[model samples]
Target: MAIAKLDVVALDCPEPRKLADFYAALLGGALVDDEAENGWVVLSTPGGRLAFQESPGYRPPVWPSTEHGQQLHLDLTVEDLDRAEKEVLALGATALDTEDRSRSWRVYADPVGHPFCLCAG
Candidate 1:
């Protein structure tokens, strides 16, 4: 049997609602559901569903620090790194680190502190 394509991408956060809102705006998605009783929130985007689950004891990743494990990251491809960086920063992403701006990729952290990268396409 062949496996079907992936349907959803889930993330753990201290506040699922807040994170859901951020992603909803970023992905141009709608808040399809928020099951507080189940500690989950889902955003429906054209590309796919992004789900956030509430974890009261959730500790965010301390990237560049081996003590904390990286939970997850999203790699986005853009036409122009500079323009994409500016847009994402306006959306509340923070600059984490970069090796070469002249190169094709840049790493950044979301508002809630998840690391992601933008690469040239």
Candidate 2:
């Protein structure tokens, strides 16, 4: 028996709407923008749902460092690595790791500094 079910992955950021829009465009989802909701945004996609929470004092983590480690990172698989990288960079994602040509994955930091991988699966 499962104790609880995993619902949605929420990312904390200074601005919810902007972050939500970024993810919606990347994931091909609709941003559920409710005027009543003050500091949150939800993107509902065919695969799953992503929620962005507003944190006034949000501070992005520094990857590969123990002082401020990555809270969590999304591993997104793509059909073509080259194409995906081009698209993400245009969407304000910074390239974090793309040196190892032997590897099947590349790392990129989202607009809000959250690290995510573009994996070839």
Candidate 3:
């Protein structure tokens, strides 16, 4: 029915391993690397696989404005938004957008500035 199965969602970063490590730590995945130093990294989780490749001049997305544009973003479901927010902040995530009364989702940027959201579902 489908042309092909979805394999991986890859991101480009200056250091592939570091980006992969950040996601693996937050999402509970196993980081895998190839023998050759091809600047490729992967994190395999129960839900899906995320990959990272080295980009010599990687510039993070400038969200809110379409000047640079946001190539992609990730939304994660959390039981307690407040608790998860604190935990993610402690793990080097920078809060891009903070919402108090509107308690649905909060925005944050990874260490390298990729936008992601913690959603209460």
Candidate 4:
């Protein structure tokens, strides 16, 4: 059989609980899974399941450096960039970079240094 669509995308983080909470708040708590625990967290959004795996020795990515490399990133579709950005920042997301703020997209990083983007998709 052919491969099925992606069910989950997991990220490595030092503290799964903290990172998961950030996403949970941003996604309106509807994307979070009931099975999320201290070591592992899962977000079940309409797009797909986003999971965070605990890495005790996890070292965050150093973007623009490319020395360590970005392991993974999430792209979220939004209707309003400005409003979305404000909500994300309030949810513990730090503004890392914005390739085209005037455009329909903006990039931001989570508290643990994982990069994600908001696009008009």
Candidate 5:
């Protein structure tokens, strides 16, 4: 039996609302900002919920390296990798490992520098 259910995956960012907006746009969710809760932001999506917390001196993790660590990354599945890659890039995602187009997955960094992958399943 499960002891507890997962509520939401939270990420610490310099600006909570902005990060929440990015995910909401990408994942098709409603953005909820709770100013009373000290600038906490949440995105409610069909798959699950994601919360963003404010961290004044937040320094984004370094990709492809364990020095600063990746912290966490989201794997978003897509039907057409090419199409999705283009859209994400336009939305402020920077390609980290996209030289090999034949690969099943490509790594990218978000506007705030967190690494994520667009995977073809």
Candidate 6:
């Protein structure tokens, strides 16, 4: 008797199309651009569906600080940490925490400042 099932994980951003493209490139998915349908974009991947909603006044959160905490973040697993890091950085992701290279995970911010992690699989 489950009351609900997880459908999609949506993120709010100033530009839905751009955000969707970024995720699509990172995760290997098919993007559905439907800005006319209420400023929403969907990315369909084997893992799941990721959506982006347009928020005109969206403000990115500051991580590790309660003043403006991270609203939420995605944890993406990769086969090779170094390779993934290089790819993501070239795709406009900012390194948030990469000082400790021995760790199993590293943090990075998407182009517009949404923090996400690249974890070793």
**TM of each candidate vs. truth:** 0.84, 0.93, 0.92, 0.84, 0.93, 0.94
Superposed by TM-score, candidate 5 places the C-alpha of residue 116 at a distance from the truth, in angstroms, of 0.6
Best by lDDT: 6
Clashes of 3: 0
> Model 4, range 1-121, lDDT digits (tens) per residue?
8689767889889877677778877775454564446577787765667788888788888775677877777888888888898899888888877756677778788999998888886
lDDT of 3 by residue, 19-71 (tens): 78788878987976541169898889877999888888899998777999878
Error of 3 at 22 (Å): 0.9
Summed backbone clashes in each candidate are: 0, 0, 0, 1, 0, 0
Candidate 3 minimal-lDDT segment of 10 residues = 28-37
Error of 1 at 85 (Å): 1.3
RMSD of 2: 1.5
Candidate 3 runs further than 4 Å off: 34-36
The local distance difference test score of model 2 is 0.86
Task: For candidate 1, give the lDDT.
Answer: 0.81
Task: List per-prediction Cα lDDT, in the order shown.
Answer: 0.81, 0.86, 0.85, 0.79, 0.87, 0.90
What is the TM-score (0 to 1) of candidate 5? 0.93
Model 5 scores a C-alpha lDDT of 0.87
Regions of model 5 farther than 4 Å from truth: none
Model 5: per-residue Cα lDDT over 1-121, one tens digit each: 9999999998888888788878877889787645525968888998899998888888999988989899999999989999999999988889999999989999998888889999996
- Tens-place lDDT digits, model 1, residues 24-48: 7666778888885688988998878
Deviation of model 2 at 32, angstroms: 3.0
lDDT (C-alpha) at residue 89 in model 1? 85
